[model samples]
Target: MAHIGPAYGSLAANQAKISAKRDPALDQEVQTWIETIIGEKFPNGSYEDALKDGVILCKLMNKLQPNSIPKYATSGGSFKLRENIALFQTAARAYGLEDAELFQSVDLFEKRNIPQVTQCLFALGRHAQRHHFNGPILGPKMSEANMREFTEEQLNAAKNALPLLNEGMNKGANQSGQNFGLTRHI
Candidate 1:
């Protein structure tokens, strides 16, 4: 008879593997961290208010990463530069947004506006849920070689921050004022 390895695909085996790795207490701690961060950032519980701070936050991000945004070349003498600026002005006028708002949004997109801790946590939670994890996975995997795992303390902090994240996400959804059917689903 030939010897065979244990069946890694069996339910019992999988359960044992998961049990060895999963730490429910640590999971709860991480959730607590997430909630705490959110509460501290938004004592009054308003994500819209946080978004209103984005312009200043984006400016700070720009300072940290200079020239990360595409500029209209205001001082350039080239015809193409003038054309681009005129086009940008026309688009801004059409959208009823100031040029600064447009630039700020671009900066926010590039930098992810991480200074808004609640929003950042919400995004991380969403991403983790999408990937079927209680929290973001940080470590090397055979499938995802570059995946990074958070330290135990970091995970606990994120857990404590979850409530604020949930509040911010919910507030943002409601503030959008567009019926995306989230109310019915949630």
Candidate 2:
């Protein structure tokens, strides 16, 4: 039998390149959290959509399911849903959703009157039990135990829950692509 050394070397090189292109596990973890929060709270929305919204579901959702995205707060002092919605739309565009109709669904709330949107986010948070996000993006010191209280469980919960959330997002995105011909443009 002929030795296929060059062919095997090329295959190995290709595999290495593919592995290098894979998304960082940590980023995937965060993405998972975003998806989980979106699903339980904003069932109709996407992970890309919820992440861009910036509702911070981890702290907001603590009583719901592991995969719930808490609904946004509705009290007078709570964050404005319209602004967050716009932010989320912007983020979604950045995350491979450029020119997608994903933002169209949120336009109605852009005119203000976002109580429903807020409520939906809060509910998602509640279901997901997200309590705190302490990462480089939000700044490491933001979650300092001295300035604030944080149980190891909460931190670990977020960490462990991430992969599952990402799985959900993958499934959701796959379904969307199957149902609506959506493609990853970015």
Candidate 3:
């Protein structure tokens, strides 16, 4: 059962689902992080409203990496505000944050997906440690590579018999003895 609506309807539904799953605690953490980094308080009560214009984001990026955003329009139209977000995203990517950790400008400017905005902020906070910036950390610390070296004998032994993984499943079960529905007639 479905409606013959336009293709964009599904996108709206997805946005609604994401918007519904927003966690207030995460939002508050993101807000605190941005404000602490930028040294400016959020103008609005909620994090989304405070960052919709993208100004604080630019400030955050700059604080993380000085002059990352050379120019972020503080007073302008929608296009200029959107540009600020784009600049922040580019700078964030350059700072080692993956594309998946960044959010689209439309997500914040148009308010289409607030959860993504928060997620992006959290990722930024988590990724900030990479720059060695002397600031408060957010979320779990990004783990470092723990390389392990093995001897040739150990490698050969592992190839010969993977004792740990070779342990086959001994827990057995069969439904042949039990009848779920009506019995078959011969």
Worst 10 residues of 2 by lDDT: 135-144
| CA lDDT, candidate 3, residue 126 | 74
Candidate 1 Cα lDDT to native:
0.39
Where in model 1 is the C-alpha error above 4 Å?
Answer: 1-9, 40-186
Using Cα atoms with residue i matched to residue i, what is each candidate's TM-score against the true structure? 0.18, 0.22, 0.81
TM-score attained by model 1: 0.18
**Largest TM-score belongs to which candidate?**
3
Cα RMSD (angstroms) for every candidate in the order listed: 28.5, 25.5, 6.0
Highest lDDT: give the candidate number: 3
lDDT (0 to 1) per candidate: 0.39, 0.40, 0.81
Tens digit of per-residue lDDT, candidate 2, span 1-186: 123344357777765664454444443445455455334444345343444344643322322223233344433322364454554444434333335334343423321223323333333333223233331121121222357778999888877765755666566455545557556777
Q: Mind giving the per-residue lDDT tens digits that candidate 3 earns over 59-100?
A: 888998999889889988878888888888899989888998
Q: RMSD (Cα, Å) of candidate 1?
A: 28.5
